[model samples]
Target chain A: MMDFALKTFGLTKSFSGKIVLDNVNLNVRKGDIYGFIGKNGAGKTTLIKIVAGLLKPTAGSLELFSSSDLNKQRTRIGTIIENPSLYPNFTAKENLRVQCKLLGVSDEKVIDKLLDIVGLSDTGRKKAKKFSLGMKQRLSIAMALVGDPEFLILDEPINGLDPTGIKDVRDLIAKLNSEYNKTILISCHLLGELAKIASCYGVINEGKLVKEITASELEEACKECLCIKVDNIEKACDILENKINITNYESINEDTINIYGDFPNSASINSELLSAGVGVNSIIKKDKDVEAYFIDLMEGKTND
Target chain B: MINLLKADLYKLFKNKSFYICLVLSILFSYMGTMINFAYNSFSNAQSMYSLLQMPELNGIYMFKTSFRGGMLFYSIFIAIFIASEFSWQTIKNIVSRGFSREKIYISKLISCSLVSIIITFSYVLVAVLYATIKSGFGKLPSHFVLNLIRMILLECLVVISITSLFVMVVFLIKGIAGSVATNLLINFFSGDLIVLGITLLLEKMFKKDVDVNKYWMFSYNNIFASFSLSNDVVFRGIVVCVLSLVVFTAIGIISFKKRDI
Candidate 1:
């Protein structure tokens, strides 16, 4: 059986009595790029911090790989919490070398290889303090990758990056997931970019995970809802159910019943309603993006 | 762990304030040399003996005095540097790289102690060599060698204890300004208060009416009283060093482990 890479059950956290994360349950499976999506202050960073062992959860159980030794599991997990933590005075090679030494991995050649993997091999002699924001972000990634971890958790990894830098980081993350076969959990504000790489996703809001779905499932399940306005409400509801054979419709008011289905087949549906003694008032179709999908999830629309 | 220590040392060496502190030490120590020259030029040996109330003046004592002077302040500066690691957010990088929190804390402690040791010894070395050139050889006090060793060891302990105490504070406080300011302030005020309280209690219990002023006794400044200890008194200094190390390091490690990074 393939095991989960990370799991949290009913995780709750508070800072000085102010609740940030409340009853969050999340699980990321092996070889999966899990997108942790949320707006700002939605407890994304808080959840990440708890998972990284940088914060103590007030209430919850966090399990990372079924292992006897936590230290051993920690060795396989690489995390960049909020920002890349590094010694600004050290060189890139020197930084990785130190990390290697701490993990008891004495191979010196791997330092250069790790830096090259992060595209920071040419940043020779420049201190991390002197690096530009994008370069610093890259160096931080290089630092996280030093121990050859099986799972990488990055919180807003592309935060503050330019468009080009964002693309570079996105490509790097893709490479890490595909070429290196490492599982990744990344939280970001860039929904479209996240949709590109994430195979699975968990939408978090107010510290609780509202929904968890695979990319294919989300594509299938979170489809756009079609709205239609007809003259005769009774006939429209009857024809839509009997003739159209699509039952997914909600009564918006006396004259409108919102129908959600395959796209704008409004012409055929409206004609069917009119022939059934219903007058066509208007038909409107709304396209739902991932952002709207999240809004729906937060609004308790998971049932639909 | 040693790798972290090495990185800590590397980071500390890059700070401009550290270099400036050394320059200030050199400037202060050289002023002692100028005073010695002035005293030698104007005063006869008899007048010097009567006025100073000491056997003789030598470069080693002048150097030792100046070198060891105000080391507590120097150590406070070191505390601020260690605290800055967290403030600058660089500590996150090292910890994210799979280094244990314990290893990182110990590394900073070890690095700070070693730096204190080196700077203390270096200051002494420069002062002694310069004094020897400026002033002719005076009688080498029998206690000089042991005193120098004790001074170095005491200085190291003082640095370790103070830095570890500050590490605990930083771990609890989670910021540079709070840890540095609070630690230096508390150490400055309570260090003397604690030492005085202990010294008074010890004196009362032992029934020793020993004049306190005869020796630099029972305060943070006593950390510099390396040459004052006789072979019989060496064990006392050991007790002080060990107790401080155990207590401060224990608090530091425990607090760090419990703190959310």
Candidate 2:
């Protein structure tokens, strides 16, 4: 059996008679970067808050490290939910020191190491309120990593970071998972950035988890294809199948067809349609990225 | 819980607002001593001392001089120190670390109570020392140390109970502005406006005289300055303090547990 870091069953949450999380089930395996995706009010943060014990579930339960005793099991977990849990007047080191005391981490040297890890070592005497947004985020991450928690849950860690800041956070997350042997559940709006680090994904929409897919599975689903719009649908299919011998194609609509395979470029496909006397409106090369897949999922266009 | 307390104490000492409140209370306490000194010297004379009277500043009422106004500063202290945990979301760091909410609530209560005592006694300490310099420690009642200790313990209970009430207000409001405003409103009005309103309403409804003083905390607080309580008053003070502490703590814990962080 696969060891799971976090798992929930039929978890539901409601706020003042309005359901925020509706019978949601989520699974995050050990040692995997699980990217939680959703729009605003999609229950991503709510579920994270519940898992962190900041909010109580209205119904159902969850297990951390496959144990029903969440209170005991949660000690091995670290989380950064919504904003960075910080004391604004204190410096970054001071903030981490408090976290250290709370977590019973006695190694004072770890403070310097964590500051160095987050590239915040030079921020001496600068209070957290004086730090820039990226610095605040980095300090929060360092604070979360204080006790070397096995499971880390970060809600929108890179929400408003610049490109460099985003890359820095991304690299730090990847390093923490790779070098530290940690399991992470992170939610972010930047799907492209998340796609770079997440090994698996959970997509939630309208307070419901729509799908859970691995990176390889997502790569397959979002494979590069050639999209062609034509006037003649039947003739185009016959010509493509018989003439081009490409059977891996999907008919998106009456006039549009998406062909997926190691086929020639869009120009070749376009010429093939024209040579067969089929009216080809347009033939463009399409690389469906994570953003595209997410849009399709949100729009309910995908059957899955 | 120990670790949480250590963290809370670390925060308590590091917070600037705490020192500000402490200094403000001490200043007010010293001002009280100066006013008493002036009143005893120049009560009948027409001088700057005539303008210094606030609610008849006669007799070296050290406890009242230090405590009544000092409690107002404690309101701001408790509100800022506790409520900011919610506003700044620093509480999440502890709660998400797997510490039970009950432990967190209790730890906060202990810290707030301890700090309240510190603030309250510091105010008293300033008055007692200053008054000793100006006009020695007055006549010692029989069994002076023992009686003083007893008085201090009762005052501690009252202070804890009052701090717990402020904690409940902060938890329920959970915002700095709202919590601070409500705490001040309660501090300024609970003793007079609210109790007076209740007294009038009860008298009119029951068609008789009913003394609500024994049942209310401020009523007990008013009598605490006397530095000696009869068995009856001590029993009633203990009952009122214990009851308020339990009720306020329950409400605070319930409010904290039932909400979404």
Candidate 3:
């Protein structure tokens, strides 16, 4: 009944004197598709592992369901860290049965339903070793859903999937959040894919949480701009600054400039540029995607 | 803990290697009896002069021989089973499911002990059947039967203790090949020969009478040998076996809890 599904306070972990996660404070509210974004070895997996209770933190505290007793709280959570933890010799259904046993769920119907949910119901009698990476990932997801956990933590759940597989998993994640009201803590390198379903975002860099913002906040942060391609970039800047009194703009290169402020009409700007002998080649509106925003955040170009 | 044990048992049942090891152990047990019978027959046909012609073949002797020879197979099975968890990365799933590492360790130990017990019982059953068919229950006395049952139970404890040692090796090494190799080396090479060699060297160097057998009761020849089952030897063996079980189980549990995976 906690407001937040998960919250970490100064969660730090080190390996052999090398810091993997350094004072990372993260939060995932109820029914949030919290997209954890970072590059490979950016401590994403390390943090996820700590949250899953697979690795104890060297320092810090984590609360799941507002309880600091992670071992007890972990029963209400499911996780797939790094690769899908599965027995290759067993079939997908068999693997799930094993997971069901671990979770103390005896209902065979639940296993069947989960397999159907993950699009693995048709894989009859095929051992997991024979499964492709995508199939294996789906099966891992099914395994994680065995006990119908209220909170799910998945680390790079779509790493090795094909485009269709990625879409399936994305839709499944969305469905789990929207329909089942499950709070998800997911990390993936593909920011574009993450952008499709993530309701909240957390950017991690060098083992530190650099930014935590909602999707709407990210949308507002990625400001819209008008990009103009001109023959003389300096002349165009001078005309916009001196004639039109628009100084809140920056030149991207020799032929391009991004105008940040709003102007009345493109025709007037074009006419002004033409009168000033600046050849306007093209005018286009540019919108920043989550990937670009993430890059900017990681590179310290954006203020938190 | 009970639920965890149930899950561990489920995994063990699903493992094909468990059944394969059981089958091999049974065959090895029967083969031991057959070979002994063949050797006795050959000696009688050749009329070779011997100190004791055709040593008595009883159910207890056959069971003891078969259990000792089959111990390695069971140990290897346990190693591969534990190692497969690491290789397949399924330990993460179990650990993340909120079971304490201590419970997980205890569950595996119990499951592996069950496996050892099943295999030992099967080996003994086959050995008993073979002995009955070959020798018609030789020298069936009530006291001897009671003693044999007592010895079999004690031997089971010893086997479980040894199997715990293998489980510890598997957890410590965390790899199939390394654990199996280390288990084999310790189970076979470090038993009596190494103890005798060390004793002889110490005696030669320091001129002292070092009782190797008294110090080391882990040898196959001493622990599994057919003897009178004295009160002193039985008590000491039980103490040593219990101590070994505690040590191995402790090491395995501690190592497993501390490991990252």
Q: What is the TM-score of chain B in candidate 2?
A: 0.89
All candidates' lDDT scores? 0.72, 0.87, 0.84
Order the candidate numbers by DockQ, best to worst. 2, 3, 1
Model 3 lDDT tens row, A1-304:
5499899999999999999898999999988999998878889999988888788899999998898888899999889999988899899988988888788799999988999888999999999999988888889988988899999999999998889989999999999899888999999988899999999999998898999999988876566777789999888999999999888787777888777757546778889999989899998777787788898877657532
Interface root-mean-square deviation, each candidate: 3.0, 0.8, 1.0
**Candidate 1's C-alpha lDDT?**
0.72
Q: For candidate 3, lDDT tens digit of each residue in B123-206?
A: 778987898788766664457767766777787787778788888999999889998898888768655578989889989988
Which numbered prediction scores highest in DockQ against the true structure? Answer: 2
Name the regions of candidate 3 deviating beyond 4 angstroms: A225-286, B45-52, B201-207, B214-217, B220-228
- Local distance difference test, candidate 3: 0.84
Across A231-277, the per-residue lDDT of candidate 1 in tens digits comes to: 67887888888888878777767887777766347778877777778
Residue A118, candidate 3: C-alpha displacement in angstroms: 1.0
Q: Could you tell which candidate, 1 or 3, scores higher by lDDT?
A: 3
What are the clashing pairs of model 2? none
B128-161: candidate 1 lDDT, tens digit per residue: 6677777655666677776667676665665555
RMSD of each: 5.3, 4.9, 5.4
Question: What is the per-residue lDDT of model 2 for residues A1-304, given as tens digits with 9 covering 90 to 100?
Answer: 9999999999999988899999998999999999999888899999999999989999989999999999898889988999887899999989999988888889999999999999999998999999888899999999889888999999999988899999999999999999999999999989999999999999999888888999998987789888889999999999989988989998888998888878877787788889989999888778877898986775556732
Candidate 2 regions off by >4 Å? A225-261, A264-287, B44-61, B192-201
What DockQ do the predictions score, one after another? 0.35, 0.72, 0.65
TM-score for each candidate, following the candidate numbering: 0.80, 0.87, 0.87
TM-score of chain A of 1: 0.83
